[model samples]
Target chain A: DARVTQTPRHKVTEMGQEVTMRCQPILGHNTVFWYRQTMMQGLELLAYFRNRAPLDDSGMPKDRFSAEMPDATLATLKIQPSEPRDSAVYFCASGPGALDNQPQHFGDGTRLSIL
Target chain B: DQQVKQNSPSLSVQEGRISILNCDYTNSMFDYFLWYKKYPAEGPTFLISISSIKDKNEDGRFTVFLNKSAKHLSLHIVPSQPGDSAVYFCAAIPGTASKLTFGTGTRLQVTL
Candidate 1:
């Protein structure tokens, strides 16, 4: 089965440090999404890319968070000057198209802890 | 503003019984809805979905019912099993947008 792969399954960092999480979506998927999961917020969509072009990122903190799909296979989410509140399990999902009916497949999230 | 809401934070059901999970949405534009199941330390997996045009969709043991007028949906698992225990999230796609708006998940525990 083709699965989305996430790197550094766990990461612990101090406040003000930079944290980068990487994901490789399933092959042939054209849409990529980033999400953050926290106790209070559950799962929130941070950003998404369709055909390598960003379609929406209204959920992300513009000043500290950034998401990019450098290539079709790889997608990255970065937090500069990370804060304690930034600690959460970040997930990456991908789908075959940018259609509402297509279900996005997810990767085992990158759990980040900022102290 | 939370467009999607799952009022029940958790539910417990005995094995071989019926398990019903409910979800509601405040957005009138939401045209597609999905239910995802997640185990500890694992990403959520798609369980089932229903479109606004249809009232229900079923896949084997899982069935999703959508009430467009009420903006509510429910997931029913018949003959619930121990393996069905997990955190289930309700999500929706507004209008023609591809992004999903999710509800705070409801943890379902199936007791044997």
Candidate 2:
């Protein structure tokens, strides 16, 4: 069965450190999305990519957060000078881009805890 | 502004009884809606979906009802089982492969 895969299931870093999370979307999927989940906000869309091009990143902190899809299979989310308030579970999801009713397939998620 | 809203933060039901989770949306442009379920350590998984043109859709034990006029939708799980206990989220999209707006999830607990 095909599934979205994420690395470093859990990460703990000190404040002001840089953190990077990686995801491997299911083969053949052309759209990738990054989301942040927190108690106060639930699930917030951070960034999304279609056809390996960044479509939207408005939800992300422009100066601190960045998302990129270097290839069709790989997507990455990075945080520079990560803050304690940035602690939350980050998820990577993918779907067949532009499908009429596309359903996203999500990875297990990376649990990040910044001290 | 929160486009999607799940009024009930949590719901508890007795096993074998029916569980109904409600969700509301503020966006009139949403044409498709979906439901997802998440466990403690796992990501949200797609459960069911309904199109704006359809008022109701059913798949086995799960059914989704949509009311376009009110911009509301609901998920009904028949004969709720203990395994059904999890966080349920409601998501909506305005166009094809567009950014999905999600609601604050409702946690469901099915007890014996």
Candidate 3:
């Protein structure tokens, strides 16, 4: 069964450290999404890319967060000068067919903690 | 303002009984809705979904109902099982091919 794969299942770093998370979307999927889940904010969409092109990133904090799909199979999310407030589970999901109601297959997630 | 809301933070039900989870949306433009289940240390898994054109959809023991006029939807699981316990999130898309907006999520506990 194909699934989205996220690396570095866990990460702990001091505040102000730079952190990077990577994802390999399921083969054949054209859309990739990055999301952050926290107790206070729940699940929030940080950004998404379609066909290796960023379709939206408005929900992400531009000052610290960036998401990119370098190619059809690889996507990345990076946070610079990370803060304690950035602690959360980051998820990557992918879907096919120009979006629609197609259910997204999500990665297990990368749990990050900033001191 | 929060567009999708699962007001109840948690719910408990005895195994073998029916469990109902409710969701409300503030965006009148939303035309598609979905439910996802997540367990500790894992990503949310797709449970079910419904479109504006349909008021109800079901697969196996799970059923989703949509009330367009009230801007509300519900998930009902019959004969709830302990394995069904998890945090359930309600999500929506304003239209086809649009991004999703997720709610805070509701935790469900199925006990014997």
Candidate 4:
């Protein structure tokens, strides 16, 4: 019954405000991923961390978006000066290992709205 | 530049019929494919998966078929039920790549 836990199931903020989303991956999982889902773009991987170290963040906008895993249990995605276009459902997923055959388990997601 | 694509955005099928969802990938380096089912407001749940070496994998009423030569894969659900109606996503993992490249997803509706 282990699952990835995400905080703040929904968020609404004005444009230019900072928004932070948090995730707690399943215990003993080593890989964590952050993704954004939009009607136009579908689901896009924004960033991921393996063993508490970032493996990729190329899909994220470096100027305003940041993803971090302070420890194995905590992963966070923050958007500074968030804009309306940033509105989307942010999902956090975790797997047992990096590049393993195991499927990533996802959290319910945080629905963010930037006005 | 979508490496993975689910051409059909939606599908409707009668209950007790077979539901087939197709996905095509452009990346030959992809060695593993997976199918996930997502309900509204819920996370995508892993349904089934297939490796490059295998052509088919099954779990209960769900089966996944992979065609490496055609770079295509499909998910088949037998005796589709009302509860089976959801968005299904196809995802791929390239050789040694840690992340999954997901398709746009297909919304399936089972009608009685």
TM-score of 1: 0.98
What range of 10 consecutive residues in model 1 chain B has the weakest lDDT sum? Answer: B93-102
Clashing pairs in 1: none
Write candidate 1's Cα lDDT for B1-112 as tens digits.
Answer: 8889999999999999999999999989899999999999999999998889899999999999999888899999998999999999999997667779999999999998
Residue A110 alpha-carbon offset, candidate 4, angstroms: 0.4
Off by over 4 Å in 3: none
lDDT of each: 0.93, 0.93, 0.93, 0.94
User: Residue B55, candidate 4: how far off, in angstroms?
Assistant: 1.0
DockQ values of all predictions: 0.82, 0.66, 0.76, 0.76
DockQ of 3: 0.76
Sorting all predicted structures by DockQ, with the top scorer first, yields: 1, 4, 3, 2
> Which stretch of 10 consecutive residues in model 4 chain B shows the poorest summed lDDT?
B93-102
At residue B55, what lDDT does model 4 achieve?
97
lDDT of 3 by residue, A1-115 (tens): 8888999999999999999999999999998999999886789999988889898999999999988887898999999989999999999999886755788889999999999
| Model 4 segments more than 4 A misplaced | none
State, as a TM-score between 0 and 1, how close model 4 is to the true structure. Answer: 0.98
Residues A1-115, candidate 4: write the lDDT tens digits: 9999998899999999999999999999999999999886778999999899999999999999999999999999999989999999999999986555689999999999999
Candidate 1 lDDT over A1-115, as tens digits, reads: 9999998899999999999999999999999999999988889999999888899999999999999998988999999989999999999999986575699999999999999
Give model 3 RMSD, 1 decimal.
1.0
Q: Which residue pairs clash within candidate 4?
A: none
- Model 2 lDDT tens row, A1-115: 8999998899999999999999999999988999999987789999998899888898999999999988887899999999999999999999975773589998999999999
Model 3 global lDDT (CA atoms, 0 to 1): 0.93
